[model samples]
Target chain A: MKRRSAIALVGLTLALAACDNMANQARRNPYELPYGSQENWPVMPLATAVARDEPLKPPSPPPVTMALLERGRQRFDINCSPCHGRLGEGDGMIVQRGFPRPPSYNIDRLRNVPSQHFYDVITHGYGIMYSYADRVEPTDRWAVAAYIRALQASASASLADVPPDKQKALQ
Target chain B: MAIFTPRANLFMNAALIGAVLLGACLLLAIRVVPVIGYNTQERFAPEQPIPFSHKHHVSGLGLDCRYCHTKVETSSSAGMPSTAICMTCHSQVWRNAAMLAPDRQSLAENIPLRWNRVYTLPDYVFFDHSIHIAKGVGCTECHGPIGDMDLTWKARTLYMSWCLSCHRDPAPHLRPRDQVTTPDWRRTPSTPSGEALMADYHVHTENLSDCGVCHR
Candidate 1:
């Protein structure tokens, strides 16, 4: 009976050990590996060049379109929503306690920023935001930028957003 | 009749060993020697709608390669000298020449010169001329030597294996930014050793072997 009990205990211990190993693996790769620019450039802790003095020239291929915005919305919901929050208010559960609280997308500073500026920030990453270059294609970056604009517009839109005909219908 | 022949047996064994060694060396040489100059001569030949000659334009007139292929440093596709860019010189110089007939035909037909692509990589390989040039990988890193040739063909095999040779470790081919477009650029005294340059640039080799890189 003692030998049988010992054998049972050993089996339980092995099962728990395997469970713990699986839990660790699940925790290690929560998202994709290497989420940003892999270059070993010097990360200036608190670099003062946060805002540019002069305006950046236009983006290489130019501005985002509505079609791009719709595509961007899909990509954002898939990739960004898990951490950035569905509404982009930075209230994602992971961020509420300890994970980096990504800035809200409705902020005027980022909303008014040039599309290419947003593209660069997403591609190269700024602050806690990891670069999405590997996961997102170049054109999709523009799409994401468009979706951010749509989100900003939705958040800020007033009754004035409705046309006069639509206003009459509401009345 | 007088053959107590242990000495003769030893000599025959040595000759057999020598023959095997020679055969192995010859097989290795035959496989390797053909690959040495395979990509160099073919990639530098000239081809265009007008049959423009690098020998006539560059070697004969001593004109710079950059003067025509202006975006070779700045953009990809070497900007495929637009019809307007070509007509800038050809209009004034070769206006009445019989050899210039094809150039006139293309311009009249509104067909851009379908210059045969000489150096091409498989579509899956993302070879950014800008990034490579920016990081100081020279034109000849893949194109061999173009300034001396009169025609163009595939200079490098441009196979994934060829790219991996440099990508796995690009320590022997890095040069300065100015030397990036220089056709005759090679690993010379002034050039930074490829290893030091890759280190300075922080180009990681951990993912260099990843199939997704070249394949996707």
Candidate 2:
């Protein structure tokens, strides 16, 4: 009889454990809200002609000023350099390890592409690029955009390549 | 006896006043301190998976935020960008520099940078970006003035209470659809109050404020 009581007590404990687990599962399920519920948002009127084609304005010219580049460089190091190499070589650490490689900016195809395309990609996040919308401000994204242009120019530049106005400014 | 009584009364009155004043101040700090809710600090300066900055891209170069973070209106997760995006330009730029350490590491190591999230909702909360964007919510409504910030900070407390306050009545925050992308788009003569718009949509405020609407 004593042995039977021990077995019954064990069964009761198992039943209680099962009950507790079910309760916890219910709580956990409640916390994870379902995805793709469309009806919750308030109705907003459709917007016509948002800036889809027009490219965002570029940043002010860099005089190769370290103070300016330092800010750009620091930000690049923190954000862009991780994916784009420090020299903007498209050899960013992420690329070498099996991630899709981005086109080199100096490539004729990319160089020929309008700057607006780049800006749109940065804002909206193209194939693999995530949106920096939450991470970087609008203007700062422009700054990085400008810095990127500068990096591209630096990589492909020759001493004879300086623009006439920039040559005089350097003198 | 009279002198003792007066002294005791003075001491008692002073102590009571001090206690009341202290309590009032504490209450005010909690209640009246300008739109501050709990978790404000965490939202204010969050650590991201990667240390990204807007100062360089926007302020320095005048780039729009939309250029990189595209899917604000269409997708749920404004999807984290992959390395291919960075290499698009980095390939031919800055070939050698100390600044490209992380980029280089990511390329060499074959590891993706793990970015920390800045704006996160409780697991129970359901937020749809497309609907909000479709209905004329601009990035700034929920994100605040990101164009102006050098460092990314949580501009608004995205708690259910905060969301409901706007949902039940969005008149104060509503602006024209054209002004959605304009970061500084303030409500003008042309703009309608959230109540007026809600009336147009026939949104019921009675159950609209229900917790399940946003919570689940």
Candidate 3:
């Protein structure tokens, strides 16, 4: 009788296994609401992360290279160009859609500001802008500041500024 | 002997054949039904609190995927755009659109807007978006022509076999990391060959197909 009961139990478990899905299990996932939290709003994960072995305050470093500029351009185009525009003209799509127009990088005051000023603004947003400290990294912020300088430079750069060989490509 | 008619042979044969045919039908049904049952809805767009158009936002405005899905390159979960992110434009553009009433309400109430999920994997699957992205897989490779999609739908069934097909040979799907979020990216002649990219991205296929890679 015990043997028969044991066989029946095994059969029951096998049948149950057919219904039990390993997929779509009931465990908590990322971005799901925290369990029984009182806050009505969506609780976001902490986004303040530093680069490996980096200091709390990363000053805009020097020895900027072509690679650094390229990285800066990519990160800037993704993060800043949405509102600041690709050319830093402050005429981004979001601005066209009606967000407050940010000052163009070509403005004299902005042109005069140090690269550190741009880095600080990105870390702690300027008026009407939210802090992008969560999105843009410390190193990338310097890259962006450098790219802004490049944009400002390009706005006024003559054919003489372009390398003679590559100048034909521009034409 | 009289009870056994000649027609009894025919009846017995018919019964045996019918039983075998029924079993075959059952087997076919078992194999076929669930595939259709589950995968049928995957292609169809589900109802959402807001009818957000990827075509309008992505294709029309030319916003980068990282503009909203900020954590795609860094985290496993491609983070959803918060209500504030929506308001960055809507607060100025469509401040009073009836369609955005839910968004307004959620923001005012300080409650989360429940966006319906489009691509929920089986809980056991530990798929990392960042890793695939770092390995040079473009958004279009998995998500399909997202820029063209008006309402998002699942492009592929996140089936194990489908995953293994890519994990076994990841080269064909790779792009330059710069073009990872580009919706219309196609490999040009200048683009490196798959073998070169496999070396470049450090993708070792030898253990990619192992069960523990995903199950754990």
Candidate 4:
């Protein structure tokens, strides 16, 4: 009986040792310094200078390509369509739900504004609109800005602007 | 001088031994069976504050998972939508419905709605939503027919052994990046086979089951 008890103890010890014990595990306390804090990351000193000194325009509108427009459409649908409406008519679902309605891109004021103004608004935010710099990368912001210009153009385009071949189809 | 014979004493001893063995079996069954049974349909189905049907939104209206859980690809948490998100549609459509009273109250009071979480892992298990999504694991593999659920329940038995089963062999569970949110998506002839996907996603099986993979 004593021998049996000794063997049982040995088995139990081995079993316990094999089990995963919570020891020496990394502990993240609530007050601990967070990973990827802004202060720890590399800073671009020129960003502020660029924002202040640069004219509110890209030298010219980006070369209009179908691929770029498609990418812009996708990005605009995800980020901008929530508040700006899918067609940029300032009647998004959020606006219908009583959030402040932004001016339509088709309006004279927005239509006349330089492309750089739109880029600035997207990067730094304008009035009630929050900055999307964190959510939208710089290239994507340009893409969205280009898409907004396309939307404005579409809203005001006349039948005369349609190609002769496409005009027949429209009729 | 004893009242009973040696034979009777032996019979009594045998009966006592049988009783002890039966008692031990009963104790073992009571302890082990319940733990296994707890992961089944009856035990893990928790009630929520509001009966928000995923079926209505996903299957009926054709809303994407990202429409509500917007941060699933970007953040660790697949974020719960705020009252404003719900109100964007609800305010126009079901403006006076009794079911949306809590939502309206939350909006009026300027307080966030407290949603009961389903599919929560223990604090010790470090799971990242972005990594799983980026690695090509579809939502349905773990979440299970979320588009069909009326009141969502814990679909999988989120036990460590169940997780390790996938970690050991995750190839069969992966799909194309575009179809990761598509609940009913399957391996079509046009799509690459599971082995090719495993190579494409670079899902190396080595060190996946290491204790620190989840525990740390």
TM-score of chain A of each: 0.56, 0.52, 0.77, 0.67
Q: After superposition, how far is residue B41 of candidate 2 from its true place, in Å?
A: 2.2
Choose the strongest candidate by lDDT.
3
**Which 10 residues in a row give candidate 1 chain A its minimum summed lDDT?**
A23-32
Which CAPRI quality tier does the interface of model 1 achieve? Answer: incorrect
Expressed as tens digits, the lDDT of each residue in B1-216 for candidate 1 is 767675998899899999999998898787776566554334444456566666555545444455455545556545565565555345545568888887777778765555655664433454556667767777667766656556655567665667889878776777765556566555668666777888787777899678876555
Q: Which stretches of candidate 4 lie over 4 Å from their true place?
A: A1-171, B1-44
**Residue ranges of candidate 1 with Cα displaced over 4 Å:** A1-171, B1-48, B59-64, B186-190
Ranking by TM-score: 3, 4, 2, 1
Task: Report the CA-based lDDT of candidate 4 relative to the real structure.
Answer: 0.76
lDDT of 4 by residue, B1-216 (tens): 988987998899899999999998898787666457464442254776568999887776555677677768877777787676686567666789898899999889776666666765665778878889988899999889888888887788777878999999888888887788887787888988777888888888998889998875
lDDT of candidates 1 onward, in order: 0.64, 0.62, 0.85, 0.76
- Which 10 residues in a row give candidate 4 chain B its minimum summed lDDT? B34-43
> Where does candidate 3 stray beyond 4 Å?
A2-20, A24-26, A33-63, B2-17, B20-24
Provide the lowest-lDDT 10-residue window in model 1 chain B: B37-46
Q: Which digits, one per residue and each the tens of the lDDT, describe model 3 over residues A9-126?
A: 9999999987756765666677655544536446553588545656666754766899889988988898889889999999998888778899999999999998899899988987
Q: What DockQ does each prediction reach against the true complex?
A: 0.01, 0.03, 0.61, 0.09
Q: Write the per-residue lDDT of candidate 2 for residues B114-212, one digit (tens) a residue.
A: 555667665456676766665666778888777666567887776556787777776666655545656556776767876776676555667867777
Per-residue lDDT tens digits of candidate 1, residues A1-171?
A: 999999999999988886642212322121122334434322323655643332354346536676677778766764566556778888754455355567898888877897778789767877756566545556767787778777877788877897877888766
DockQ of 2: 0.03
Among all candidates shown, the one with the greatest TM-score: 3
By DockQ, rank the candidates, best first. Answer: 3, 4, 2, 1
For model 4 the TM-score comes to: 0.62
